[model samples]
Target: MATHLDLEEQEQLDQIKHFWNKWGTLITTVLVIVLGGFAAWNGYQYWQNRQGMQASALGSAVEAAVNSGDKARIDQAFGDLRSNYGGTLQAAHAGLLVAKAASDKGQMDDAKAALTWVADNASDDGLKATARIRLAAVLLGSQSYDEALKQLDAKMPTEFDAVVADHQGDIYLAKGDKAKAIEAYRTAYQKTAPGVEYRNVISVKLNALGEDVK
Candidate 1:
């Protein structure tokens, strides 16, 4: 009986060895791949966190410059933010602030440049749409009617559709296209939130264009 038990145990050991011989390398390879992928993901997350911190710091610098009313410092800090952290949403928000400051300082070209950057590169769709609308307004002020219309024609997020239409109405009115202006005003009126002041403004625009909005 002891001899028989010994032989059976030896056979089981041999079977396990054979199985390992066949699959050890494959199992090791799979584990290595999975672990490497997990490590890479962690590394990427770490890098993103570092980037976010840096971007937030630069954004603060931009705000400081804007507050100081220092046009040159604002321009420099904004350029740095755009160059280094353009992928971050903070960059877009900072760009908008810079554009507003530049516009207030009569730096029309600088304002347009800042707004163009946000319109083209903002991470958020709504931010991009807002940038486009503001940029269009700037262009309209400059009498760049065609360019203003082009900016307004960019795809807007659903939440911004009404505002974009209102801006389009303004652009059309500026261009003396009263028919298109009325149409855009009507669209805005239909899209605006019920009982909002903007809705009332749209109603006024429609009335001005001789289009009754019931």
Candidate 2:
């Protein structure tokens, strides 16, 4: 009986290892994000007043350019922020705004560039994860399936788990890999909290694949 139980335990361990190998460190990272909340992304209380004011000014310039509908101006303003205030929340905020403007103008490359910088340089994991998720969406729209998946490869805040898996499902589905798509959607559905509207969205995706949301 002892030998049989040991075999069963080993099998379970192997199954767990297989899941870990597939998902990398996200499972562990998810736990940390929940316990810690990785709260720094909420604000930049440590910045000196002058530095904060300067960043805010540069952020305003980026917004003006976006409002002007001038891509060149947007580029120039965003360039100034990232060059001089790259580490500030204002810079990260500008990146997101620039990406939206770029996407609206159908400048996929520009959108990717802005989002990539935020993903690579944002001060906190939650913000970086936001960039990665947006970058993946842009890549998916461009039909760069592999590249999109790469953006989501890193461990992120637990809050982003559902979004990451949903993006993966879209990428896999775009590649016509129904099996992988379904698996990714299932992961998304399970991770999403009950009664969240987004969880219902994942359920719809799974249902389209002939899979129950259970």
- Give the alpha carbon lDDT tens digit for every residue of 68-185 in model 2: 9987888888999999889989999899999988888899898999999999998878889999999999999989989999989988988898899999999999999999999999
lDDT of each: 0.91, 0.90
Worst 10-residue stretch by lDDT in candidate 1?
205-214
Which residue ranges in model 2 land beyond 4 Å of their true spot?
Answer: 1-47
Model 1 spans > 4 angstroms off? 1-5
TM-scores, all models, native as reference: 0.94, 0.76
Q: Residues 1-214, candidate 1, lDDT per residue (tens digit)?
A: 9999999999999999999999999999999999999999999999999999999999999999999998778878888988989989999999999989888888899899999999999999988988999999999999898999899888887888898889888988999999898988888888988989989988988887777798
> What's the lDDT for candidate 1?
0.91
Q: Given candidate 2, what's the lDDT at residue 88?
A: 89
- Best candidate per TM-score, number? 1
Kindly provide the TM-score of model 2 when superposed on the true structure, using C-alpha atoms. 0.76
